[model samples]
Target chain A: MTDTENTPKQTALYDKHLEAGGKMVDFAGWEMPIHYGSQLEEHHQVRTDAGMFDVSHMVVVDFTGEDVKSFLRHLIANDVAKLKEPGKALYSCMLNEDGCVIDDLIVYYLSDIHYRMVINAATRDKDLAWITKQVENFSVDIAERDDLAMIAVQGPNARAKALGLLDAETAEKVDALKPFYAYPMGETFYARTGYTGEDGFEIMVPNEEAAELWDALKAAGIEPIGLGARDTLRLEAGMNLYGTDMDETTSPLISGLGWTVAWQPEDRDFIGRTALAKEKAAEKTQKFVGLVLEGRGVLRGHQKVITDNGSEGEITSGTFSPTLKKAVAMARVPVDIGDTCTVEIRGKQLKANVVKPMFVRNGKSLLEA
Target chain B: MSNIPDDLKYTKSHEWVRDNGNGTVTVGITDHAQELLGDIVFVELPEIDTEYGADDATGVLESVKAASDMYAPLTGEVTEVNEALDDAPETVNTDPYGEGWIFTMKLDSMEDLGELLTPEAYTEEAEA
Candidate 1:
């Protein structure tokens, strides 16, 4: 973290991003591309065809030990026991003692004793410290895989394009990979999971092999996407951004992530089980919902929302959704709020319709026309 | 470097001024400004016939990245606005200097143009 703070670090594909006409910007201490030429076009490219994103800035940490599963169950809010098979993956939120989310990550069960976890770049340092501290009584060794680079290939055609890069036998095996599953081939790891709602793969390769893979992807007619479209795509998919949608001050229950919390098997205790149980018993005061602007103007984060009954809320993550061709946002509002609300933008109140957080999936609008 | 038409005047806020030669002047964000703001998605233009002081924030140009305020180059009365921009704000990104013109205004005085920066001066500031 100290090293990343001095200057913006570059990913292994930095030159490739530059050659692809990427406009670099400082994102979480890394010089990452915001877009190649047009953010809108890159967004459409992903929703329509295949697009690749250099997500090497995200930290990949590996955990291995005799008690790995037990340690994970105690460290994270979700149950890792749900990963019953090798190569299975689970999405969970690591919570603090007060039941607030520390980070949301994906953990892939590689073997009986080894699990690989990918966390946000911005929360790298604290997440490591927290995970390490929780390993006190367990026999676990934590390793941050800095030598690995991650690339997410997404869209309807993403799987076929990615599979083409593998040998026939390997392609056949990966072709049969189920959702929420992963396969490790030699040094590279491929997961049939992604942040985008579209079907795709999040592949991890050696740092030295990243540019080669990126060139191959480009030659295969996969357009390179940037962080700008990545944000919009994830928002449309109803995926929560770590710092923007929820952080240490917010619990997953009130953040529209209650489904991620494993509350069954009451005896199975996790880090924040007590606090979360207390909150559940007390009843949630706020709820998360989606907002679609009824008129013109883009919805953006930090905008205030006023319910019909005068209760106020705030937009968490928002953007001009290219797929929907309208402004869409996720907001935390009064639990009893109705379907209609007003978003305050640039001193004017704009009406919005509230619905489920998800706006689009698989290049199709989920909202009724 | 962004294109700076030598025939036009500019402001430090990145608005370009074109002398229409009939006591009216056309204004829009400079190419450098549009490049910095990125893809423009919405434009909020001031109403026609509205009066504005020099350097007043007259309108807003919202891009996919963020929103920026377009300012008045000199004291003027808004005579007309580009209605096309209301539906196709992306013209600002594609043609910031031509079809992207935001509004036309009647200048309070022709002498006010002297206070605006020349193309060379603007280039120095924008490319610095």
Candidate 2:
């Protein structure tokens, strides 16, 4: 194989990942760490103590210029104007005309004239084109800033460890920011938002300075975690992934994203509003739930869930939860299904209890005793 | 390069077989296979009395990343299974050919062993 066609693109922290014994894999066209040594150990590390991740592959987009506030109001499903206080962030899904989710992103309202967003790396091209096309008439400029590198320091003790890496003055500025908020450190940005179900910070720094900060954090005992544990952690947290949980053909209504849609304004008719209304009235819309396997077997993606009523649904994402010591999965099933169902594995059908898509949060199992 | 024992026969699917001289053969995954699967969490071995044809999928092995089925190397009847793996699946990753032995099957015929790949053949095929 030639050098050019050899592998996917690497992030700025590629060296650091290698130095930490990370097993690199191609994920969404980006070379990312899947694990350092053992995925099970990494998963437990985040739950008990602290860990860090190289999330530089995600794209950062900035929307600036006049009337930016009004332009974003019609472009996205969530109400961007809800950020009455600057630095407040909103989680939203950018939908197509048919109410299908194009991508789910986090929007940081820095000001009325400027707003920033973090989009999934795999959906970068489509999301950027959609944003550029939607702002045709509005006086807003879409600038895709690829020069920034992102790192997520997550877990119960993550914030304290991250604070240890920075100087006193910088740490004090970060300590003042509340959850779901961000603080600008000159050109650097730090937000209290994360995919893992833990208290942590998602820091976006200049590309050149990413390695130094990662090394500094590593020195403080914040081990480098990988995408393998990242999946189980987010799945346990009940967070929806971009492609596995939902995609262009799937709606936020059936894909566990109905809450992100803004329906209050009554006048802010965003894209896909009509189709979303039709879906709300339809009885055939699929429902989302979590399946906790009660029998022997690991729940895997694309498995069929057979309800007691004889209806079936498909699993969107599934994995072995390290914390719970059981197989858990997110499934989209018929609305009339019961609180328990059978997951078809191999030639046998296994029993699994149905619950909210979340299994663990804040280092505690949410499942009832 | 992983450990490919000199005396054991190999399957292209990565299962290793050893003749116990009592007409029954012991079987487990090779070191190369376990390395690819990485820290196996679960293993599903066939029942003790189960009979299987050559190349039949007897059971499954699962890791954190994915799952794969284990295929029988020859026509045989399972005589015993590794009971220790029920609680400690990591044995497959730690000692794939020793304590991690999956099952022992009495071969229908000794001639069937000749059809499996030799160590030299398997090493060349796997390294390729």
Please tell me which predicted candidate would have the highest lDDT against the true structure.
1
Against the hidden reference, what TM-scores do the models get? 0.98, 0.96
Residue-level lDDT tens digits of model 1 in A189-297: 9899998888999999999999999999988888999999999899999999999999999999989999999987788889999999999899678999999999888
For model 1 chain A, the run of ten residues with the poorest summed lDDT:
A1-10
Report how closely model 2 matches the true complex, as a DockQ value: 0.69
DockQ of each: 0.77, 0.69
lDDT of each: 0.93, 0.91
Using TM-score as the measure, which candidate wins? 1
User: Which stretches of model 2 miss by more than 4 angstroms?
Assistant: A1-7
Off by over 4 Å in 1: none
Q: Write the per-residue lDDT of candidate 2 for residues A267-361, one digit (tens) a residue.
A: 99898888988988887648989999997679988999999989889999999888898899999999888989999998689999999999999
Error of 1 at B82 (Å): 1.2
